[model samples]
Target: MTARVLVAGIGNVFLADDGFGVEVVRRLAGVELPAWAKVADYGVRGLHLAYDLAAADYELTVLVDATARGDEAGTVHVIELDTGRTEQTPCLDAHGMQPDVVLNLLAWLGEAPRRVVLVGCEPEVLDHRMGLSPSVERAVGTAAGAVVDLVTNHGR
Candidate 1:
């Protein structure tokens, strides 16, 4: 069967560069996509995202977000996550936005997808402000393109 893919943009747009994911997905929505690829803006709802992952049956799920990776700002990264080995954790906040927490929760709920990937950018700042810095903003187009490539190549 052809893999079904979900491209999710995750972050809090109110926080400076942390809004990278949201912006990327917003841009991606304007692009043409394959029938098997789906895009969603999860913003800061980790638990809701977790449940959505659990409820849906997708073969590949790509998570796009701003990560605190120790790198130069606006740097884009693609990472493949190993699933099916999630550990049990305590209560979960349905509105949480951390990708790791949401993935762990999905594993806990026995809803981990077959394959997962993370496409993220290094944030220059994360403050209680709206809009992205120049560097991070520039990376959004690159990230969105990268995600489209991923979906087109992997989901078909």
Candidate 2:
């Protein structure tokens, strides 16, 4: 059967913790995922994300991104994007688009997933350099575990 839960990791790997999303997916690769969970490392490419939001068959989607939520470095936050409060909150990242944009666009296209959850991480450093910061690297496990929990519980 087609997957029921989609986990997308979005970020720019070259820019330190900007790659948090991708790194989380990488760490999750070693674990055994349910049959209905699908994951991908979608590096920075708005069009790519738009495509998946428009064309995927999953009923639920989990997106991981580097966010500035004023949390400590390596902090993992599980954000329910379906809530109304997120609509007015502006994201601190200038290069990235809000998760709402993806949901709204998919809704407009009549391809929206049944539910969407956003997993966010505060960046210790987003410098345009190679690799994740030490702190952010340490947070990968936490972020990956969060995704696993979300998918394993809701996936079926």
Candidate 3:
């Protein structure tokens, strides 16, 4: 059966705090989630994510990534995306997976979830590295819990 919600973990593992999403989802693997919710690690594969979104008719899509919103590093922000806004042109790059680009590609494909949300953490360092910074690593569990809350309490 198709999942009602898609939890997509996206980022580059080699780029320090950019791996926040990937780590958060990894933590989620240990937690119990609803059967209708699906979690995936789509690290740096924006095109793959877009195609998956286009092919499936999900009620909601949650994208987890490291976001720089000018706040303190390791700050987790849950922002709801306005799927109705599709003014930007779609661009696809296999190596670079920007959330906006994936959303634009989904829009271009004429398929979108009913609601879209981003679970983003403020990145400390995006430099080439194998692991997340201390701050970002600390926020991984918080972000994972937030994702769990979102999926379980949706529409309640």
Model 2: lDDT equals 0.77
- Indicate the residue-level lDDT of 103 in model 2: 62
lDDT of each residue in 1-156, candidate 2, tens digit only = 687888889888888888899889888889899877888887775556756767766777889988889989888889887622223322333356456665655555556566778898899998889798888888888888888889888834
- Badly placed stretches (over 4 Å) of model 1 are 1-3
Candidate 3 — what's its lDDT?
A: 0.90
Supply candidate 3's per-residue lDDT for 102.
86
Alpha carbon lDDT at 13, candidate 3? 97
lDDT tens per residue, model 3, 27-106: 89999999999999999998999888888888889999999999999999999997774867786688988888888877
Any runs in candidate 3 off by more than 4 Å, and if so which? none
What is the Cα-based lDDT of residue 8 in candidate 3? 95
List RMSD in Å for every model shown.
2.0, 3.7, 1.0
The number of clashing residue pairs in each candidate reads 1, 0, 0
Show pairs that collide, candidate 3: none
Looking at model 2, the pairs that clash are none
Tens-place lDDT digits, model 1, residues 1-156: 343889999999999998899999999989999877889999988877888888888888999999877999999999998776566683676655887788788777767688889999999989999999999999999999899898888834
Higher-ranked by TM-score: 1 or 3: 3
Off by over 4 Å in 2: 83-98
